[model samples]
Target: MPRGPPAIEKPQLEAKKGKKEEPKKQVKKHVKKQVQPEIKPEAAHGESNKDRRKQVQKQTDELFASLDKEFPVNQMGPEPKQGPKTPATPTLMSSSSRPMIRNPPPFNAVVAGTAASNTAPTACRSAPSPPFPQPAPIAPAPAPAAAGQRDDEKRWDEQRWDDKRWDDQRWDDKRWDDKRWDDKRWDNRRWNDQTWKRSRVQDWRWKEEFERKQKEMDEVLAKALAREDAAAKMAQQERLAAEAHACMSQQAAMREEVAAQRAQQERLAAEAHACVSKQAAVQAARCLAWTQQCATVSREHEQQQQQQSDAPKMQQQSKSAPKSAGNWKHKNKPQPKNCHTNPGQNMRDGRRFKEIMQKNESLKAACKEAEGRAAEAEAKNKELQERVAKTAELMKKECKSGKDTLEKLMKQHEECKKELKERIQKLEARKKDLKERISALEAQNAKMKEALTNEQKEAEEQKAVKEKVHRNEDEQKKAAKRQKTEGPAKK
Candidate 1:
């Protein structure tokens, strides 16, 4: 039984009854006097009694007025009777002794009736729960016990109390059944049969996908590597081509320089030859002048000898005629030949002078010829010197030109070498980039494979959740579909 308040004794109820009796007696006296006056003379004899009644009525009315002044009658209602002073003993009642209490009528019943009259059939159909019921009272659960208490003991006690009248056999059977049940049986079975199969299929699919992707990556990498190799080969070829071109250019330049040097040497040789020829011509002129002087001297000597022989013949004839008388006179008067002089000697002398004059004229003509030849030789020599000087200047210019050309060619070769070096550097950089990219792709592929492995495991879990028993078949269908689509798309 539930605990109850202390019981109320009989003495406390009697005391309350005695407190209410005075007000009841006063009301009876006031009503009895008014009714007795309505009867005949015999009732007139009850005038005194009526006076007493009036007096009681007045007192009662005054008491009621005082009560109304203190506490209005309109505010009065039946007061709740106090319970007995002693605690009440608890009593257990059967279910049949207590009436089933229904909910009270709402204050808006008339308003609801009017609204129901006004509502259309369609409106009424659409309105859900038109007559709402009062909400039920919610009971709070018992508070938990303090720490150090056994929770199982507390729960057992509460259950025992709540089901106090329940049959022990039924309770034992229900408890036994609940205790024997295994909640995870279906989950474990489903995971072993269906989820494992799904996981296996998914793993196979993931492996195939990884293999295909790896092959694609390998193909792309190979193509990139081939392109890089081709670029490197092209660069090498260009470098060799540039080197060969530079070598050929150098050889041609050397040959041209040799040719120029040979031409300069030939010019110098021709100049020397011209100088020797001029010297020889001057010598020949001098020899011819000496021969002419010798011829002139020989002619002069021959004329002198002939003149001496003629002079002696004339003198001998004159001497044989007169030795005595005229000899003194011939001696004194001088001989006629002696006086006249020898005509032959005079003729010879004249011839000799004429010859000498002719010889001198010839010598003078030869000297003039020699002078002219010497002058011509000198002029030619001067001209040759000038030509030599001009040739030397031309050779110097040519040499300078060759030097400038060689310098320009060297600069061009240096620039080409530099360009080739730059191209090689670019090729090396491309190779390095391709190597790095391949490494990055490999890392990404590894990461993707790890993720796919995890995803396949998760898919197995999801398959169990979705209760898909034929997980392997579904996976195979999906794999086939993906293969078909991906194959066409790749092409």
Candidate 2:
């Protein structure tokens, strides 16, 4: 009769030649997780593998968004570029005995209804995935060899065991076909730290450039303001100088006019004094002749005394005349021309002095008029000086106000800068705290998943052991029954 399938044996791992083409185990446990991220969100409740994958993918997208936008990643196919460094891509193969599902199963069987769990996941059809390793099927324990068994029977049993081993080996090979890096779409791309460092350095350079531009703009604005202030000061100085020069020119013109008027008045006064002195001298001469004619008797009495005095004077003169030279002329010099020997000459001199005094009086009147004009000019000059002083004070006040405003603006700028710095620091601290909390939560979740997976493995192992024990006992009872029946028949 045709024999049945060989007795099943425990699944055993097979040894392979090389490691490159050999596939590895799968599931999140086998793959490495992303390293510490700069920014991380807190973990939330998730039911299935798809939810977890989506979460991790979102975080990865956020972290590399800048890079990805700047340099788009190639996501054309599942196969990587062909190079010596590139690893082989996984291929699906058909198999017998065990049915392979083209679609993925429901992630959470407990949450899904029984009917839903039996159905495949909808995502598998849209997206292709590599095969995954399944748990090894439970096998019955091997039957012990009979003591009286024939040589042919031993050979057949050995042949059956070999066939069973081969079948299990085939299953193992198909299950772990493409386990390593199969979960990631971009696994072929380079993940060297140098690439990441380059991107980070680029970002830093951009920030520095922005800061430099801002500083340059501030400097430009400051220079423009300074230039405007300097221009205003220069204009003010020019205007003040022009006003001062005009005032000085006006004062000089007024002084020259007063001096010219005074000179003209002095000239007229001198001419008038000369006319009065000549008229007085003529009147004195006329008066002197009249007086001499009236005083003849006095003149005769004076002549007798004069002759007595002249007798001694004439004798002295005659002696002095004989020794007279330039030295004798100097010793007996006649009375100086200014000496008032005649009464008429003295009278004319007094009259001339009086006329000169009267002319000085008239000149004093003209001087008074000039002084009045000077006072008026001085008053105008004082007004102009007051105006200049007022303008200067106004400029000073404006300058002080400008300085105060500048100082206030500076204070406000400093305050705002400090506030912004404080706010940025607080936000950074908050971000750090959130990141730390998220990392802790992720670690905790990983530990819990690991424990659950380990517990499942232990439970499955214990169940397999128990099943093997039960199968062995059943086979033992069957062998004993067969020996009892066959033993009687052989006799």
Candidate 3:
């Protein structure tokens, strides 16, 4: 196999590969021994040396030819080496050595081309020798590091490679870093979204729990209110019952008093009946005594009549016989002076007996009339007592009915009071609710009024703007007309 150029294995490549080979050692020694910086010769301003100009032009062409084979170039540096004979062609160069052209071109281009041309100036009449091998391309500089860090200029020189290969490696590192940063950002966003979702769920659960608790509390309050109402109703009923009982007791006492009065009236009537019976017995005894006196008087009158008839017969017989003379003699013989002494006494006794008998008859007639009047009075008294008993019974009945009506009225009054109280409470609650509703409505009206006022202000501003625009347009129109008219006049 053919051996390649010694310039291919530069000391820079050995440092990058980190190899200790024999060829790399030999190359390092050779590079260290020939440590010279190449310089391009400048042209003189007024000299007319055609040979020197030709020599400089030839060296610059050879330098460009070797660089074209080894590396690709887009543009040359601003400051370039100028030749006296011809201008140097602008050559493309790698980034690492682009600045070095201001200092020196590489040793390979200088030694291979300029050395022979300068030494054998006369031998140039013959053809030139074969071209020297090109130098290897240099690597690009690395990107700037983090803050407080310096760019590694030496490392760039040590790892010299082609510009294309270095650009590919840089692009790969940039792509990897960008992908890692994007993944980290995406992960952080995902974590934030998860936390927000959990918070929302917790808030919803808490709201539901609060609503449930409120409902339970409301139900408990309603139950307590109902219990209180029931207790009030029961107490009212008990009070009514006690009132009824008291009324009944009062009625019983009244009935007892009425019964006692009836009993007293009955006893009075019995006493009056006994008095009438006794009066009747006394009247019957007086009638019987009067009848016996009248019968004895009649017997005495019959006896006296019989005695007078016999005496008259005897007197007629004696008057027809000698008894007449005897009676005259006996009468004459009893010549005791009766007409002069006993005549007044005998006459007074007969008159007094007749007056006493007439007085007894008048007294019996008066006693019978008095008995009849007493019987009428007793009958009138009995009628009055019966009427009083009937009136008392009517009064008792009225009292009992009155008591019953009073108890009913009392019960009705209690019921009405309870109903009125309930109505009042309901009305009060309704009043409160209506007041709250009215307040809310008034607030809404106020808000509406404010909104309407704002709208009116906005409308007024729009109207002013429109008016201003119209006035401006009219002014412009007038100005335009004046300009037209003035143009004709000036012309």
Task: Quantify all predictions' global Cα lDDT against the true fold.
Answer: 0.45, 0.43, 0.45
lDDT of 3 by residue, 1-491 (tens): 11111111111322422432221110001112222233121112212223433565587568657765654343321211122211232222333211011122222232323332322211101111112224333224335554322312332222222222222222222222222222233334445644654564466446546755775676576557656766766676667767777667767776776677667667766766676666667656756765676566555445444554555675686577664555676455542232223446545644654764775677667666666766776676677667667867776787778677766867775876787578558756865775675577557546654654665465466446545634654464355435434533553
lDDT of 2 by residue, 209-259 (tens): 675577567557655755675576556556555655665565556456555
Off by over 4 Å in 2: 1-347, 358-366, 369-377, 403-407, 421-425, 459-463, 466-491
Kindly indicate the candidate among 2 and 3 with the higher TM-score. 3
Total backbone collisions for each predicted model? 9, 0, 1
Candidate 1, superposed: residue stretches over 4 Å from native = 1-356, 466-491
Better of 2 and 3 by lDDT: 3
Alpha-carbon RMSD, each predicted model: 30.9, 27.8, 29.4
Q: Candidate 1's residue-wise lDDT over 4-87, tens digit each?
A: 111211113234323322111111111122122322111222334335435644764686578568755454433222221111
